[model samples]
Target: MTQTRRAIVLLSGGLDSATCLAIARNMGFESYALSVAYGQRHAAELTASKRVAEALGAREHRLAMVNLGQFGGSALTDPTIAIPEDGGDGGIPVTYVPARNTVMLSIALGWAEVLGAQDIFVGVNAVDYSGYPDCRPEYIQAFEAMANLATKAGVEGARMTIHAPLIKLSKAEIIALGTRLGVDYGMTVTCYQADDQGRACGRCEACRLRRAGFQAAGLDDPTPYQIPER
Candidate 1:
C-alpha cells in the first residue's frame, strides 16, 4: 500500500479556499484543514470552514485564534472602517489586513513542521481577487523561500512546497473546477460583510467577485445572501 503524504491546507471557508481543499484531496494527500480567526468582522466564514472540512473529509480540522482586531488596521479586522459596498477602488482597498497572510502562513508552517507535512495549500488568486499584496504569486514564492530557510524541516533537507493551486485561475475557472470536484458551494462564505448567520451582503467586493464568477461560469450561485426586501 502506498503511504499517503500529509498536507496542511489553509481553509478560509470561502469559495476559493474550499476549492483548494478539494484539489488537495484529489491529489491523494491526507489533508489537514486549518482555519484562523484573526479578528475579522465576518467570522461566519469560520463556521463555514468547519462544515467544509467535514464535508470534504479532511483528516483533521483546527482553528487558531489571533486577535488582529486589537491593532485595528483593516476593515475586516476593525469595525471602525466601513466595508466597501461600491466595490474596491483601483488601488489596494482598506480590507487588506496588515501581514495577515504572512501571519496565517507562519502559523501553518509551524503546524506543518509538527505534522511532518512538507506541503501547504493556500487559495490566493491573482485574477479576480482583491488587490492584496500577500495573494500574489511573487509573495507566495518569497514565502516559500522564507519557509525553507526558517524551519528545522528545511535544514534537514526537506523541501517545503507552498501550493497556490488557484493562483492563476480566474474566479470563473475556479468555480467550474470546484463544481467538477463535487464541492458544495452553498457551504462556503466569501462575503467580507457576511451576517452572523453566514448570509452574504451581496454588495461587498467578495460578493461581487463571487457573483460574477458564478455568472461567468453559467452556474447557479448557492451562496445565501441577506437581500433586503424591495
Candidate 2:
C-alpha cells in the first residue's frame, strides 16, 4: 500500500492559496489547511477559507489568530493606510506588511512540526507579485533553510520540503489550475477592503488583480466585483 503523504497547506481563502491547496490535494497529499488571522483588512477571507478547505477535502482546517495589528506597517492592518487603487508599481507597495509571510510561515512550521508533516505549501508567487519582498523565490528558499535549522525535525535529519507550487505561476495560470481542479471561484475572497457585507470594493489592488486574472483567463468569476458606477 502506498503511504499517504501529509502536507500542511497555508490557506488564505484567496485565489492563489485556494489553487495551491487544490494542487496539493491533487498530488495525493492529505492536506491539513492552516489559516492565520493576522489582522489583515480582509478577515472575510477566513470564512471563505473554511468553505474551501471543506470543499477540497482537507483533513484538517484550523484558523489561528495573531495580533499583527499591534505592529502595523501595511494597509491591511492599519485603518489609517488606505488601500491603493492603482495596485501601485515597482519596488514594494504600501500594502507590503513587513515580515508578514515570515511570521505566518513560522507558525505553519511550528504546526508542521507538531503534525510531523514534512511538506509545507504556501501560495506566494513572484511572477505576478504584489512587489512584496517576502513573495520572492529567494525569500522562500532562505526561509526554508531557516526552517530546517529552527526545528527539531531538521536537527534529527528529517527531510523537510517547503512547496510553493504557485510561486512561479502567473495570475492567469493560477486561475486555470484552480479551474482544472474544480475550485469554486465563488468560494474565495480577494478584496482588501470588502464592504461590511463582504462584497469586494473592486478598486483595491487585490480586487484589481483578481478581476484581471479572471478576465485574462476568460473565465467568468462568480464573485461580485461590485464595480461602482463611475
Candidate 2 lDDT for residue 11: 96
lDDT digits (tens) for residues 71-90 of candidate 1 = 99899988889999885559
Off by over 4 Å in 1: none
Tens-place lDDT per residue, model 2, 8-79, is 999998889999899999999999999999998788888889999999999999988898889998899999
What value does the lDDT take at residue 104 in candidate 2? 90
Q: What is the C-alpha lDDT of each candidate?
A: 0.95, 0.88
For candidate 1, the TM-score is 0.98
Q: Count clashing residue pairs in model 2.
A: 0
Local error of candidate 1 at residue 43 (angstroms): 0.8
